[model samples]
Target: MDVDLPYELQLVTDLRGHEERAWQIAWNPVEPLLASCSADKSVRLYNYQPSNESLKFSHIHSIPTGHTKTVRSLAWSPSGKTLATGSFDSNVGIWEREGGHDGDEEAADWECMTLLEGHETECKSVAYSSSGTLLASCSRDKTVWVWEVHPDSDFECMGVLMEHTQDVKCVAWHPSEEILASASYDDTIKLYIDDPSEDWFCFSTLTGHKSTVWALAWSPKGSYLASSSDDLTIKIWKRVAEHKWECALELKGHERSIYSISWGKGKTGEESLGWLASTGGDGKINVWDIREPPESSTGRVLSHKLIATLSSAHDVSDVNSISWCPREGFEDLLATAGDDGSVRVWKVVPSH
Candidate 1:
């Protein structure tokens, strides 16, 4: 029998004014707000909240000076105090949260802090490490740059990760590890680990996807990794003995290219093997239950079962990105941004 799963989707907000596709969306780690960047050359912030048994979002601010061309990717710092965005103009922008001092009734304000210029082509992705110590960005220029974050110093370029032969689409940091993973149109995922000398080097390469690998994420526990591709499949991988990673399982359900992937935290105080959620060009979101490898298995081996499937979640356009909100109490909430110029939120309920 087919497992029947359902999702309660509510149109949280109609983020308009983007003449082109919306590429990326990110949620603040400390506040109920989201930042979205689009091909319209603008970035917008929304005050998001749950209301009337649904998600409600309203636009509060917009940044037009951050990028001269299309803004493709956005990320928030672990402290939730800073925002970073990447654009087709070959630049990255850092935004700082201002206001909110003692007895200040005004809402927290945001301003562009600095602009990073290095990439020669469009920058595809930007991410802040969990410790907020490093900012990483990947670009069509076929290189990834790591920046050292200092409150007193402007964003300084620390090192460059140069390996991919094609446009790098995404970069993700391992939750608690000193490892960074990046996916590229070159059909490869490169893992960079810091050496004893405090310099980062490419430790390993994961190659299995037949097409472009667009998105990648590390599980919350930092035990497993997930990558989605234009090949229309999601692959789960695990670190094996001696700093090597092997493909464990392959999930094949999406009818189109998978654009984004995210891992969900387990129940309260529970050690989660974790769940993988992905969005695709087919306008669907699928959640996979990542299982632990069998005891007798050698190397990295993971098994996964399709836990839930959401069809037409973004019926109006292609769902470009999916993220699980990072609030301490709202682990079941999922947010999606799409080409329809809207961001939607869904509540995930497990099968009882």
Candidate 2:
């Protein structure tokens, strides 16, 4: 079905069996595994094959030791060896992947490494830095805490980022930088940068969205940022100078609240197409291509082409989260989890 735009939705994987809605889905950074957490108080990990788009998922393990309520968010370490889950029980649990390189023989060796408790209310999101050295979490209590990860030592609370006046919805680490970006119900995106000599602090605030900003992501180059919001728009910003940035473009096309946004692959040259993929409450996934402006006297802003639009992508359910594979070779594949109690994988194929 065409929704007044371009883009095709092909069902690559139909991951079912969840008893409740899935709030978060993450693609493993090192392996072809997909981790998803749900309101049913369960966490599942699936092994996906990108060659033929086959999914062989087993309940590798479940968290019975941490949260007494629903599990809402999860994040995998940069090494993909550790998984962090945040839940409504007001705590975060770190899960370690046990067992040696040998397969199923040691599959029952997983364990909960630690329980991070600080938030006075339900934790909304959790993310691990690119180096696997830090983890950041946000909650409904209107606080974001940064944690330092140690191998043989106890995890330390590095710092707490307290700037949002309301609940923080999402937190993302820049691909290769020490900067972090957060979005909140206060309709703003805050950038946190650490000084090499001192602590981390809010360096800048991006104010453009008319509604709650639900998601934020940094481009792989760490030069640009993207945010999606309930205002049904996606805003792209570029860091021009030290501690200075501005919104380069505003993409308006979605009919409902946008829940997630991600950058696509093939961005390597001046003429390379930088794609933005978004999932929304209207049950659609939209792909937009950011193009450079034409050479003319009229200084028009850069334009984005609607490359793809998928209607009924979740079949009447709201897509709550979407993530692109962070590894080098898997850029064309995307994964999304939704209120439909299913996780779907999509592969982008260029039109001839």
Candidate 3:
């Protein structure tokens, strides 16, 4: 069921080194580095540079994270100086360059600065806030923990949220706010905010997905959020009121469970809502252009167009994770991690 897509995903390269399933992919927001974690209990880093007309990626370092179990997720700090790894061992490891340098030559020497431990079970995902002052991690123990980042690689637990009835799958911070969103196996997405007078608490619980919610990504403007689910669908949630959000649209196309989705500012110009890319157990990568309705229209439904579809994106292997390059000039680039233990890079180009 493949057709000529409007945009072509040109193969850039395939990076193979992980010995087990690749679980996640994260691109540094301020640097040209790409990181991926795997079931092999290791995190691999790569350096990419524009080589002539295309980009080239080199395996610069491999970190054998001392976690006793699989490294499930990783995220780069906003400053691109530190990396956080969440593991099945129920601990989060923070790593930084030995000398605190951003040079590619010093990428290999990294030290685990601190280990955050509180979760009673496997940690599913970890993310740093936009200001790099707060970190969030979710676990299979059905709770989400927030950490306050301090100077000299120190961290303090700010809040432990136990609102979910089942395992928490993912946690994502708002693009420009301290508000945090967590998806869970309970088939609900909860949004939490801090009350300066009090502490962190859930302000809203979004319920629509019939099955487990696997991932969540917010729009560039933070006005809308896209979530993928085990029910083989994606739902776009729009913030209508100050503390309320409603499902604006539902996307259905994936033939299997949708495990990952990424929202990025692609070639959609400044006014349009960014592009949404999704991949999952079907081994297909689908990119959609979500358009915000005009101001005059009082309708709640938003329109979307399928711009590209790359079937068998991982060569018959389940595409576990998909991440868009967060750099300025490389907004059209995308990276995906597969169950085959390989990472592939693709460039979106206009079709003739």
lDDT of each: 0.81, 0.80, 0.93
TM-score of each: 0.90, 0.91, 0.98
**Residue 154 of candidate 3: its Cα lDDT?**
92
Encode model 2's per-residue lDDT on 249-309: one tens digit a residue: 8998779999988876543345544677899798788887776567763654557787777
Clashes of each: 0, 4, 0
TM-score for candidate 1? 0.90
- Tens-digit lDDT track for model 3 on 1-352? 3456679788999999999999999998888889999999999988888799988899988999999999999999999989999999999999988753647444358789999999999999999999999999999999999999999999999999999999999999999989899999999999999999988999999999999999999998899999999999999999998899999999988999999999999996976698899999999999998998888899868989899888999998999999989888888899999999999999888877
Better of 1 and 3 by TM-score: 3
Return the clash pairs for model 1, or none. none
Q: So what's the TM-score on candidate 3?
A: 0.98
Descending-lDDT candidate ranking: 3, 1, 2
Q: lDDT tens string, model 1, 1-352?
A: 2356533333444566566777888988888877777888887777766679766777777777447888989999988878898989999988876785342313656677888999999999999888999999999999999998987538878788889999999999988866899999999999997777777789899999999999998888887889999999888887776588888788898899999999977342353476678997999888776767566777455666666777887775899999988787777777788888766677677554
Q: Report clash pairs, candidate 2.
A: 6-308, 6-309, 7-308, 7-309
On lDDT, the leading prediction is 3
lDDT head-to-head 1 vs 2, winner: 1
What candidate 2 gets wrong by more than 4 Å, as runs, is 3-7, 50-65, 105-108, 266-270, 292-300
Off by over 4 Å in 3: 1-4, 100-102
